[model samples]
Target chain A: MGSLDTRRLIVCRHGERCDFCFSTHRFHWLDKAIDEAGRYQPFNLNLPRNLPKRRGGYDSFRHDTPLTEMGYLQAKLIGRAFRDREIKPHHVFVSPSLRCIQTAIGILKGMNENHTKLHIEPGLFEWMRFCRNVAPSWLTVDECLAAGYPVYQDYIPVVKETELNMNESLIDFYDRSHLVSKTLLSRYPTGNLLFVAHGATLDTCTRQLCGEAPRSNEEFFEIVQKTPYLSSIEARQTGAEQFEIIGTPVPPLAHSANAAYDSQYLTTPGYANNTDTL
Target chain B: MGSLDTRRLIVCRHGERCDFCFSTHRFHWLDKAIDEAGRYQPFNLNLPRNLPKRRGGYDSFRHDTPLTEMGYLQAKLIGRAFRDREIKPHHVFVSPSLRCIQTAIGILKGMNENHTKLHIEPGLFEWMRFCRNVAPSWLTVDECLAAGYPVYQDYIPVVKETELNMNESLIDFYDRSHLVSKTLLSRYPTGNLLFVAHGATLDTCTRQLCGEAPRSNEEFFEIVQKTPYLSSIEARQTGAEQFEIIGTPVPPLAHSANAAYDSQYLTTPGYANNTDTL
Candidate 1:
């Protein structure tokens, strides 16, 4: 007890996805403009807008599109925020999804080379999706935006259609998360740690850390936003078990008026200023 | 850039080492004592402690020891710290040294399971005498530690020894370090990045970032200490070159504190609180 310092842990969600495609999008306007221009756009041959219902209703879950450029930028912002906070972690564990991997890489770019070692753990991936899952006709992007929770009944059927799909239940994800966390906690007990995961997984972890399930979409958002770009949680040893809570989230930028600020549209100051004009 | 939020990057140092052997000490004193008392110590022969030396009787470099039990504990502490922080990086780059690898693994145990991809870049490895083509030496530990930094007068001779034993020089190391950093920055300009590097290599990057060489051991210590456990640096873009120095020397733990917290002599907090028993 005397040898180890008090420990801290923080869990955060990856940034937003395209409302329509669910892929990571980089340039909202470029995509919008491309869609409007309509002529000579890539994928026009395969995905014509005026196609009949059967063909036009392509199953998005079957596709593995890379994060949109904007999504990559969001990840970069997360990375930059971590850098600004001076949070040097001993290890970085991330989910294997392309978006998560990209996010992890962007964050690493913003950090010093001395402290971080990255590992890709399959167990930390998003809850598995069963095959041939489909979104119900009643599901709407607006509903999702307003509710901030996956309308599983509407989304599950559409997802089940994908090849190699594996659905991970909340219980399954929770169990896996607990196992992974426990293994790590038992092994390293104290140091800077980072985990890049999906929103659902983050939500599950949030519930575990907070001792209550998140009650609303806004609450989830608050939890994710409040989750530090880099933060800590104290781990206490009680009898045979160790207990810890996800600590407060730390934003990378300062809370001052001059500090970088952004909401949905504005990019963070550090990233915005340093962006390459490609 | 207008569409994305700012990102953060955090970088931190790995943990302690064995004072006597320079190996990573895995078992804290308490663990060791318990193992010894239980007669469950691993079967490891006490090999001879011969140090490498140059022609002029000055010690040559050597960096191939494994982590001692205490070193393992230090790595574990670092892992816990990372877990507490909830930092999830995208890419993890590591130097291929025994100590660093062990440290990386220990830290990974504390992080998310999704970070499974571990890349071993030879360039990220420590500056080694063996790598420079130097011949083997037969000296004692005291002789090696007492040997001052390589002198200019001994350059040719050392180079020749390096040729024979594959030992690397400071200049060779510097070039390698630069290449590693440059390559990564170019490849993942806007990604989260994490690197597990050697002490000398980390020092070199810090020096480059701060635009000054470490003038003294004290100065070096201060620089490293001030480094955030996890922090980001903006990628500098000079025409085709895209990288920035967002952070500086992420230090190892304090020397004095480390000295007082000797792994061999003290008990680990998790196992027991009795220093005497250890």
Candidate 2:
């Protein structure tokens, strides 16, 4: 009704991954709460953390984790859903992470809309980690192009390996993620858009577009913990300053994927399916 | 390990409600997207908005809306979870809204711990709304005490119906919620603490604790849309300047109920859920 300052931002969490994990990283305050509680042995969290990562536990690593067969299917499902609705995004922006690239490819194939180009936006990459060892290693533009996805030629890599500069806190991530909307709103004020990124991005963008308050670290942990692959939020502008949730249509991946389904996904580089794992 | 500045702000979203709605409030950009192709069609959102008491769709009002049976059970489950873990919150803070009051009661009863008191905090109330038509009608201290929950003796009411003073914008809410941590960190510096309030409180408190950046107007909508009832987040102080998510252990609400289940909740007190709607 008003001028076209309104838009839709369909934010997607990349499909499942071997390294993009929550199972083993299950949070335990007992280790950190000791300092925050300002008391010792106040209570025991008894977090069954290491148990999930031990001998019978899973061996998880960071970066370049490929999607399981299930992950590809999940992405494809989202793509197919888009096609069924005849909703073709004006522009699709993707995080350059391995999983995101794969998910984006799956979505394109499913949509079967060859017209819209994929823009490799590193700005939508995973939250900048303070822990140097766990920081993301994004795919280069050249590599992404070689992988055969149509990447925006002008896209520049925002994240750098040598730079340890980061927003180590969820607050920092919130700030960065919050900015993504400002940029998106300004760049494409009246078009339906899609963002394929990580759990944090999904949480931040979805929360932001829905007019919800920023999340606390505690809330964030829970949000990311259950962010199943393909989980998404649909935002359609109701007014210049208002938007509405069309829905969250993440078809269930597997009822027991978190604990039951753990198919081995490729972990190393130069693999056949580079789009789904890095 | 670190100094007293360390803290874990566990934030909780109040339970389900008939009014915490998303139906009918569906979204739209225009009626159609002409694209760079600029065409137009009347795309109706088909929202099933309630027709009651509407001059033209906005007869917004606010008061205490009690929790459904399921909501009560959900809160109780969270309390029971804390008790089972021997996790005792040294201090518990509650928003003055009725649902929050009810939820705080449920959690306390389930905790089965008698030492602490429920602080009826207005600072933790919903971001102040400037629209007089939608101002919150909080239960009087006398009314709350009569309801049988332990009301903080020193607690003072902050929001006034006659006064226009309030934090109505997301920026305002963010600033106020951030201050909540400053006050808590200053006063309770070292102890397990709990915050019980609405979806906005959950989002603001959690984001603030995790040290997230300020939110713009666009980011706020998506955040509020899918705030699941009984949803929660756990914060763990990793160091004075660092915190981690321990986990979100709120068991599924439908899983069970406590022996002390009370069905005749105060749902008809010239009140509806004041929160969410505003």
Which candidate gets the maximum TM-score versus the true structure? 2
Tens-place lDDT digits, model 1, residues B1-278: 11123332233344333223322356432233224344322221111112223343211223244344334434444455456455554556655444455556655665644344545555665555534454333223233234321112211111222332145555565556565665665565664556665544544443343344333444434333333212222322333432334433221221111111112111112222323211
Candidate 1 — which residues are off by over 4 angstroms?
A: A1-278, B1-13, B18-63, B129-168, B209-278
Single out the weakest 10-residue window by summed lDDT for candidate 2 chain B: B256-265
The residue-by-residue lDDT of candidate 1 on A1-103, one tens digit each, is: 2223334344434432322222124643224324444432322101111211222232321332234333443455446545656655555666544345555
Global lDDT scores for all candidate models: 0.39, 0.55
TM-score of each: 0.31, 0.38
Positional deviation of B277 in candidate 2, in angstroms? Answer: 26
Q: Lowest-lDDT window of 10 residues in candidate 1 chain A?
A: A256-265
RMSD to true structure for each model, in Å: 19.8, 22.2
Q: How well is candidate 1 docked (DockQ)?
A: 0.01
